[model samples]
Target: MTAHVQQLHRVNNLCAGLEWVADCPNRLARKALLQLIGEEVGFVLEGVICASEQKIPGGRPPA
Candidate 1:
């Protein structure tokens, strides 16, 4: 649970940063912005995969 929570926190922070960058005019070129978004999406997916793979306490499945 701790690991899952930590990964989610990281993902959340990345999303916040992305939002801030996107809101800024001329912060990134169109291609660069798309690339950054794609990379962030990969990070989010990785977090989800990590969370799903985590073992729950007492051998119980995740809620």
Candidate 2:
């Protein structure tokens, strides 16, 4: 999220946004924000985000 959106309809939207940040392409700012989301990632996404540090490829996690 480069810029903030003002109108979020539901609380779940925030949660969904976190999932998007987790699974979507790499963004240093987003990753930084993701760390503040708490420790439920392993239980919630089943390692979808926690399994590795890369999402797109050809970067750090490729090794």
Best by lDDT: 1
The models' CA-based lDDT, in order, is 0.68, 0.49
TM-score for each prediction? Answer: 0.51, 0.29
Report the lDDT tens digits of candidate 2 across residue range 1-63. 111122222234556778777775668867776775434433444333333435446535532
lDDT of 1 by residue, 1-63 (tens): 676677678767777677666766774574587578679768777767756756545543445
Question: Residue 1, candidate 1: how far off, in angstroms?
Answer: 2.6
Candidate 2 displacement at residue 28 in angstroms: 1.1
RMSD of each candidate?
Answer: 5.1, 14.8
Runs in model 2 deviating more than 4 A are: 1-9, 33-63
Candidate 2: TM-score? Answer: 0.29
Model 1 misplaced stretches (Cα beyond 4 Å): 27-34, 54-63
